[model samples]
Target: MSVAGVGGFGLGRPRARRTAERASRKVARNVGVPLLSIVLLLAVWQGIVVFFHVAPYIAPRPRAAILAVTQNWSTLWPLVLGTIRETVYGFVIGAALGLSLGVIMAKVPVLQRLVYPVLVLSQAVPIIALAAPLVLILGFSVTPKVVIVAWIVFFPVTVNVLDGLSHVDQDLLNLARVYGAPRWRTFLQIEIPATATPLFSGLKIGATYAVTGAIIGELAASDGSSLALYQEHANSNLNTAAVYGTTMLMTAIGISWFLLVVGAEVYATPWQRRTVARRTWRRAGGESDG
Candidate 1:
């Protein structure tokens, strides 16, 4: 009934329309930016190849790579699935065992001393060098692939977690002692939380290693069902395009696995999420104030 009420009603429609337009613009930017960037990259690549007269054998054009993927879809599907299955199984098993070992090594000084050096030395050994023996010992079955992947994934996670445990704030430890907290309680409450970032860092690295290890295992074990065998055939036939396509597929798989682990890290660390939210809110508040 008031003048203000009348004015609010009159302005509300325009405000709503403006809000919708802003939101649509934001969505368009989000979608369009990535698409435009990819288009530009492909265009540049194509132009370079055209100017240089790059042979397909040396580097397939983006169109050829795409065509190879589409054409080989049926042939590559099973091999892709097999590689994924092995990588996943290995990641889970390796993470489980490695996390347990890390916990033990960190909590007990004697065990830490005994195991840490061995873990370090094992990492120093060339992974590829061990591939043949692994195949010989475990055969071309899934066992060797899983073992190799686990071995590759284990060391990084173990080292990161152990370092995290070691660096848990002594002040926090003393505070826990003052509160009459048990050793395990202190570890769960203070140590593990403090070490979570490093642990996740290791996990992310290990996830990529898991994929690489699985590929290596496939190469060495030479089972007919694996992506390595697909590569072997492609290499033999000199279908360099297909080989490049398969490599791209492997790269995509690794990237996807890394992103999955990153998602897990972001989900597990609420402090990180809240920190980001606060920074965004502060930035918005500053802009509003300005």
Candidate 2:
């Protein structure tokens, strides 16, 4: 059969132009807005410092903070690596636990009732309180820090996943069962797609928390090379530029990790993309954008 839908049968140039337009818009929305916002924020920050004659020791100008990062990069680079390592390790451990426990709890509602309260209670306890005790128990090493990060990551992932599993489309599930579809087949086709969005939502939330968890862990107990330790020293010496620089680095880490999760979600869940030109994006020759 002759092609009809895509590019209006033969108008490939129009279709290509539309695709390029969409890609340009996507780039502007994703990159341009944030870049503009940051520039505006830095401008306001610089203005406030200069207009008020604020002391550098109290609140350094944004330029000073950026300079601090460049000047002290030799000292900061190790701390960055340390924090990233802790985040990755904790994310792996916590994500595994969350996924496994979510499945178990969904399958066994009675156990969920019994154990879910304890999990909630654990979170209600302040991280500082939990961190101190954990340090005492796990010792003043990277182990305690990793455990703390994992603790922060576990709750959100488990909760989102459990909710996703419990809320899967029952009608579809029944149809699968009625037709005698194998359990594995039903899971791969139906359940996995059902849960993919929420699961990644949980993962993204966990990723944002990962760096904060590491910072908390480091504050609780860590060697001198960690970000928390570096920040503490800077604050004690009233080096506010360095303080802001470290804070900016921490924020960057959290944002970068969250973006990594988002990229993974985009790759793993095509159905969620749900775009008009998904066919065009896939470069299917003569295929309908519909």
TM-score for candidate 2: 0.87
- lDDT digits (tens) for residues 1-290 of candidate 1: 35656655554432222366876898689668867987898899889988999988877888898789789899889888888888988898888777888889988999999988898888888888988898888888888888888898888888888888888889889999999999888888888889889888888989988888989999889757789878878888888888888887897788789879988987778677442344533454465552
Q: Which is the leading candidate under lDDT?
A: 2
> Which RMSD does model 2 reach against the true structure?
4.9
lDDT of each: 0.83, 0.87
Estimate, for each residue in 51-148, the C-alpha lDDT of model 2 and write its tens digit: 99998898999988989999999989989999998998998899888888887898899999998998899789898888888887888778887887
In candidate 2, position 118 carries an lDDT of: 89
